[model samples]
Target: MATIREELQAAVKKLFDDDKIDYFVGYAEDYGHTFPAILTKDSDPSRLTFDRKSYDNLANFLPELRGSRVGLICKQCEVRTLNVLAAEEQVERDKLVVVGVPCPAMLDPRKLTEGAADLDSLDESYWQEKCRRCLERNTPLADVFVGERVSTPTPAEGWPLLEEVEKMSAEERLAWWRRQMSLCIRCYACRLACPLCYCHQCFVEDNKPQWIDKSVAPENNLHYHIIRAVHLAGRCIECQECSRVCPVGIPVDVLNNVLSRDFAERFGYVSGETAETQPALTRYERDDKEDFIL
Candidate 1:
């Protein structure tokens, strides 16, 4: 009996050997950390591994590999990203071979390693918050499913963070965000880490119009984040990679999550849920609710 990792490696190797895919994207362990690895037919499949620490969205590499036949691992969130990219025609579905895995929640190494010397000492509290609320632990869109089926737990009730923020007065909320913005060092780690942010020229990098100043000031940081959030309103897949990669520990996903929730609540849209379901902001309806209109 083979483990899931073995099964995934076998699948990828088979595809590569059969010449069905030109490259493979999955997690490989090296240098004491599991990171995204690109594998070819000549690559060693034995290096591939799966664990809570395999937190990167493999789809981030898809844009760079466009037009090439690619086989890649897909967790629930990564599958959703593929769907969104497919809906936007950013990817050619025929060129992809998806090996879906039943995600068992990713770990936040920062929390689990702060006091613990070994991973086994960590408990459920170390799992990412998004995993607790995940609705798609099993991807339905895989070309081939790996591992045994695992049931996703029912998400806990209520959006506690959103509720807490909603309770803050407008001024208090503004001040709170200002403080968060001040902590940003303009590293753009959040932008670079996001799979959906594949724009060849992001607004902040444009000097022709100088859309936003290239400074580390709080105002510029706020402006950059606001523009990013607006651009991702109906497109973000809530992977939390932005928040995960922030060197300054900003909760960038909070902004994206708030917008996602609002889009779902108001427009009955959830990004990447389905290819046929039009994106909320990309389409218009005569009867669209206008309560938010000023």
Candidate 2:
């Protein structure tokens, strides 16, 4: 029997041989780090691999490759992202091939101790927070399935860090967020890493009315993040990439998570679950509650 990696490589090779894709986006391991790799028909498929460290949401690269037929490896979160992107008309589904893979949950690099060479020795405690709460291990949608399906874990309860913040008073929560925002260097890695933040020109770059100051102060950072959270209120898939890529470890996804939870409870909306469902904030029904509008 072929190993999972070998199977995935073979599947991708078939796509190329069938002329189904112009470009393939997947993960490649070098030294000890795994990073996203883009391959063409001429590139070696053996370079493609997936492991516990293959945590990047490959859908983030789709917009740039819009005109080309692209094939990408989709884990559960990436599958959700693809659905959201397709619904938003961001990508042409017909021009893309999705190769589904069973995710074994990515290990949190932060939790790994120094010299922790043995990944198999770690357990669920070492998994990323989003992975810990993941309800699906098998890709929900795929053009071609590559691996044996893995059983999904029971969904975890509320996000612990988000709950911890919620327990604080409004003022306390504001202060906590202020401290986190203060550490931001304004690099905007969080926005860039997001698969849904595909605006051609971000608001911060607008100088017409200057929506935000160019300074790197806490207030400016807070304003930028607040607007970002509001924009992603119904669109964020909680892949946790915003928090994962933060240089200051600000847990930026907490803001998006708060909105995701609220939308789930108040509007019964879950983003990226299906391509047919419109984003919560984009569509409004007559029955929408407006008690907080006053």
Candidate 3:
């Protein structure tokens, strides 16, 4: 049987030969690190590969590639992101050729030993927190699937870290967030890494309103993050890329996860499950619960 990597390379080549795509977004090995690569028709299809390290949400590259037909390798999370993007009208579904892959849970880079070899030999303990709780392993939407379907892991119970934070008193929670904010350098990697944060001008950049101060401070950082969480309340797909890219190692996704859980409980909504469902915040019913409103 052909390995998944070989299958992916062959599939991408076929897409190019079929004139189904103008560009292909996938992972390539460089300097021992697997990183996102944008391949043109002239580029070598052999460069394409997928593995645990192929953790990037490839959909993040799609908005910039608009007006061109693009093919991309998508895991379940990336598929969900595409669904959200399509529903938001940020992407033209017809212009995309989604090559779906079964995700075998990504390894947490932080937990990896130096020169870790035989990544495939590692067990579930080495997986990222999000992966442990992932409910879907196969892409829910795809133009073509390139791998055998993998068995989905039984999802772990509720978010432990979020539960820990919830247990804290109001004052303690405020202080805890302040400490996390203090470590931020305000690099905005969290926003940039997000596939949904495609706004041309984020609120912070608006000089006319000056929504957030340019200087980095705990209060200012907290304000920025709070506003960001609000914006993503009903839209965040919980890919956990924000926390993954945080230089300070702050658990940024916890805020989004909190809202995700609440939305599920209060409104029975889960973001990015399908392209047809409107975002929870985008639509309101006459019977919608407003207990959170003060």
Candidate 4:
């Protein structure tokens, strides 16, 4: 149950001492909080750090570091993404090291702005609401783990927003989505921030009879979002980065969560429970409740 800084240094030092790694990709204190930074042989241990604002899912470092060995910190969401990448052959398994950590909760930048003038002094109560319902603060799938696993807190039984949306008439739902889509800028910040949207050629970038128009207007925006969400339906780990990175502050995770909850309830599946478990869509059982077409 060491502090993130202590465990990080020990992990890095062990890798280097054993000549097992040439570089360690992890977070180090950055001015006010921790951000991703690569530590090499000559790096200083003083650079390593961990704290509340260390919100970046370290798995984002994997795809970009292709063919190189990596050691990364993972929360439940990040680990799910790494598992998806491994299944796709985008991440090299033998060369990677996973350091799972118990994530208490992550704060929204907007919440950060509303609460504290400085990140260090931000109130614990203002931390993301997701933390309140978190069931798996400590991850199970790590080559080496960092903290004493905290017991998963009992999750609140309802997603009020999702339920409210369900209560909307179809026309009302459509109208609401249209209004939200009107604000999209199509900068792809949401896509880039997502750990699971790592396709080599994202649909928005495809030009051969491109499936979606590039205009940031509502038509294109809605189309793009629908396509993106479908691609992530079963794969999303509820990292909420898409919503977090949006410049216009769209609640994009709402869409992803809708599907994730559906996947869990309909199929009895959850993402990132293990690094190697197959995606639900990738397999099917004959006894599955819906398999009978009669």
Model 2, span 134-177: residue lDDT tens: 86888877888887888988978888999999899999998998
When 2 and 4 are scored with lDDT, the better candidate is 2
In the predicted model 2, the residue pairs found to clash are none
Better of 1 and 2 by TM-score: 2
Off by over 4 Å in 1: 114-123, 285-287
Candidate 4 lDDT, 1-294, residue by residue in tens: 567678778877887788776667777886565677887777886777666777777787778888877777777666777877777677888998777777766666676653366554555566665556565777656788876666776766766567887899999999988988999888888888887778888878888978877767898898888888888878887777787668888888778778889888877777765677677778887766684455
Writing each residue's lDDT as its tens digit, candidate 3 over 55-150 gives 788999999999999999988788889989998998999999989889989988888889888998889889888898787898877889988998
Q: For candidate 4, what is the total of clashing residue pairs?
A: 0
Cα error of candidate 3 at position 43, Å: 0.6
lDDT of 1 at 164: 82
Name the lDDT value of residue 56 in candidate 3: 88
Query: Across residues 137-159, which tens digit of lDDT does each residue of candidate 1 receive?
Result: 88777898888878989976556
Q: Pairing residues by index, what is the TM-score of model 1? A: 0.94
lDDT of each: 0.85, 0.90, 0.90, 0.75
Error of 3 at 270 (Å): 0.6
